[model samples]
Target: MTEPAWKSPTDARAEFRGGLRVPTAGWCAGWTQANLIAVPRALAYDMLLYAQRNPRPCPVLDVSDPGVVSTRLFGGDLRTDLPAYRIFERGELVGEVADARAVWRDDLVAFLIGCSFTFEAALAEAGVTLRHQEMGVNVPMYRTSLRTLPAGRLGGPLVVSMRPVPASLVATAVKVTARYPAVHGAPVHVGDPRTIGVTDLDAPDFGDPVEVRPGELPVFWACGVTPQAAVMESKPDFAIGHAPGHMGITDARDSEYLVP
Candidate 1:
């Protein structure tokens, strides 16, 4: 039998380069899918400090040495691994590209932030069906009125990813995810999106929103993309990030991110 294209990290990159531009959820399940951010060496320290201050949404996984394209934690080029890349020039999203090879820079620093997809995999194992995955769409993400602790020029509204969990299993979802603090631990907010300034669940700031079925509580998690949100506010001269829901698949197992 031919193995699925996304089953291997290498193959996943190939699939992405082959023009597969959609959410990476449920693809390469059990492996880690990271949020990628590449910034000039000048802002690297501020970004690092930002991640440290806002660890819930910006947990550090692997940070590449300046000019390095290969990852120490995974076997893939930083420039070409992710499914999609978002380029931000002067705080505004200028373009979405398939790979960032052309814009690769010697002074660029790439950070691989922990993603909730690992926890989502755990949730799936615990029988919490990810509605977005089932519906074949990106998990909904929202830009909240909540603010992240600022680090230099790197600070902005907190970004969150939403998943509608069965009301009965909301507790189970929380418990299962709480074990992986490095990968966004657990639900930060549940129930009312208005509490977080999410006016409508149907229309998300980023990614496609899934239906909130009757009796399903919309569970929210601090997202890896929070840095991107912060970057939008800070508006560096140049920056690169993974498109929401499109992530850099890594060889590390999801269990590697679990806490005792």
Candidate 2:
């Protein structure tokens, strides 16, 4: 694995805060990465309930009070620390920006959701190759046919990220990831992408698609991007989220979310 440019979560956030935008998959080594989603306070309860009902794809790490820019989990500014942000209005994506300070609202409540990238270090240690990281691209993500249980006005199809795992290491990948339940643990589906309504692996709804080698099986994990999907489908009046592959690196350690 290539060495990351920055070593600590704080350093990584500094790079992002300075307007550097890139997928965060291998950025902060053992530190945990989080998905950012901020919505109006009026919709906060519904967002919380939605995560409660769909814990697999929407695992909650830390939630900021309305208009709060930082949380215990994240020490940096929420509006400017992440690599990229997506702005939504009435569920339609309107802008992708390097900084969200201009669009941030005082009434907004931000949720820091667990990301699968937190476990990539564990997967690599276990000898499971992460194709996207190996190829220097964002992990491929797809919207599935499976619908999440609704909460108030929030409901949408489940979104999943795919990693091509060698046929022999598939079980190892599952075992290693299953230990990190807080980060969407285990493979929700393992073999055929079509089983989950994904017809073409080459064309992904978000992030760059990776090559599935001859001896590999495309493994899928529930993605934190699911909330963005919800925002797009449910059409909340206003929403802000991390760009598909870009994420918020948190101060929390990956070991904190590891299961016994």
Candidate 3:
């Protein structure tokens, strides 16, 4: 099927509703991209607490009321908004699907976590570059040894997405991204990946790697995938989340997430 060129969140979501499964990194530019996570009501409290405790990696943007697909901040259906989803059963990935409607239950709660893509364009305008976006690949993500605060049984190593920024613009990238608190703000680690437990940049546990040119630094930001890592470690009975780079583009703008 031919996909329509999407210039708006509505358009991106409409395409996703039609079974399009593309990385949302470069889509709906300037819109707030969200990491989706849905768990049964029994586990929703722990997940909510986990996000609250680890705001950088799992910033809570908008959470759905139990059994409700609609959120107060955005007008959209959560069930078919994102292009790809991963279903987990007891810490194991059971399947990848285009939509999670089949697993929807009256007691299910959905979480829309903030994404760093919300700040990438600002960094670009500030003279920082995005190698992964330039190379047309998913942003590189690694499992870090940094542990998130334990909330109930949900706790694990923090996950980070790596972006190679020019050494000259490294400070600018940090300053620009720090303004957006809802999104994972600022670079947590700005140098050697080994310092953060990543053995190799080319072998990311999630997403694709970008080149680190000479005089460039590998900048790491807390990634929303951190929750999924916790899911894998804690082995919840069931959970659903956005697949890697695929995100939910909300009606909200990136500017809305920026703090003064």
Candidate 4:
């Protein structure tokens, strides 16, 4: 069997065009993307509990029935819906595929979690430079010493994404993101990485590290990966998520998720 390709929802949609169904990048733009988790019905409740216990890292958006593949909540099909699916057995990555039709089970449930990419457009509009986009690399993510509130079957250290911001714009970045709590809200930590147990700014637990210049301070925010880290430690029988940077886009606008 060929290993499955993991493409973001946008890339997947673009590749679905005629003559090619391969994994491609740069699909949908400006749409809200999401992190996904699939588990057996037996463990769904506990998983939702896990999400509730850790809202910063695992905010819940939608959930499908035990055996259903249709999720109208975000207005997208769960099967042949996005560009790809990842299979994990006992916390191990077994393979990646274009679709999960072959392994669909009646007891499987899908959970959609908010992603930080939802704020990228807003940041650009504000003139905040996203180093990862400039370098054409994934955002830097680190596992912090912080502990998340534990629930039924999940608990672990917090994971955060980092972006280098010019000292002048760091404050503005916080105010802009504070408006969108559904997508991770504001900065969790700024200036020093050691305060969060991240010693080497050059190496991250996930994603590529961008350059931190003389006047720039490393800004960090709670990341969706926090839930993934928790799930790995929880050792649930099964679960799935978007390969970092990849997310499912929804019809909702960014302002819709902002707090008053």
Among these predictions, the greatest TM-score belongs to 2
| Candidate 3 error regions (>4 Å) | 1-6
What are the per-residue Cα lDDT tens digits for candidate 1 across 21-113? 878888786788899989999999999999999999999999999978868776788887777899999999999998788877899999999
TM-score for each of the candidates: 0.96, 0.98, 0.96, 0.85
Strongest candidate by lDDT: 2
Runs with alpha carbons beyond 4 Å of true place in candidate 4: 1-27
Clashes of each: 0, 0, 0, 7
Error of 2 at 107 (Å): 0.5
Q: Candidate 4's error at 154, in angstroms?
A: 1.3
- Compared with the true structure, what per-residue lDDT tens digits does model 3 show for residues 1-260? 33332478888788888998888776777788899888889999999999999999999999999978878755778888788889999999999999889976788899999999889888888977788888988999999989999999798999999999888888888899999988999889998999999999999999997888999989999999999999999999999998989998888989898888
Name model 1 segments beyond 4 Å from true.
Answer: 1-6
Prediction 3 TM-score vs. true? 0.96
Clashing pairs in 4: 4-96, 4-97, 10-27, 10-28, 32-249, 33-248, 34-248
lDDT of 4 by residue, 1-260 (tens): 22122334444444432123322122244556677778888888877897888787787877887777756555655655554666676777676655666766778888888777777667777888888877877788999998988877667899998988888999888998878887788989998999999999889987787899899999998888676777677778777665566555555555677688
Clash count, predicted structure 1: 0
Q: So what's the TM-score on candidate 2?
A: 0.98
Error of 1 at 2 (Å): 4.8
Model 2 ranges with Cα > 4 A deviation: 1-6
What order do candidates take by TM-score, descending? 2, 1, 3, 4
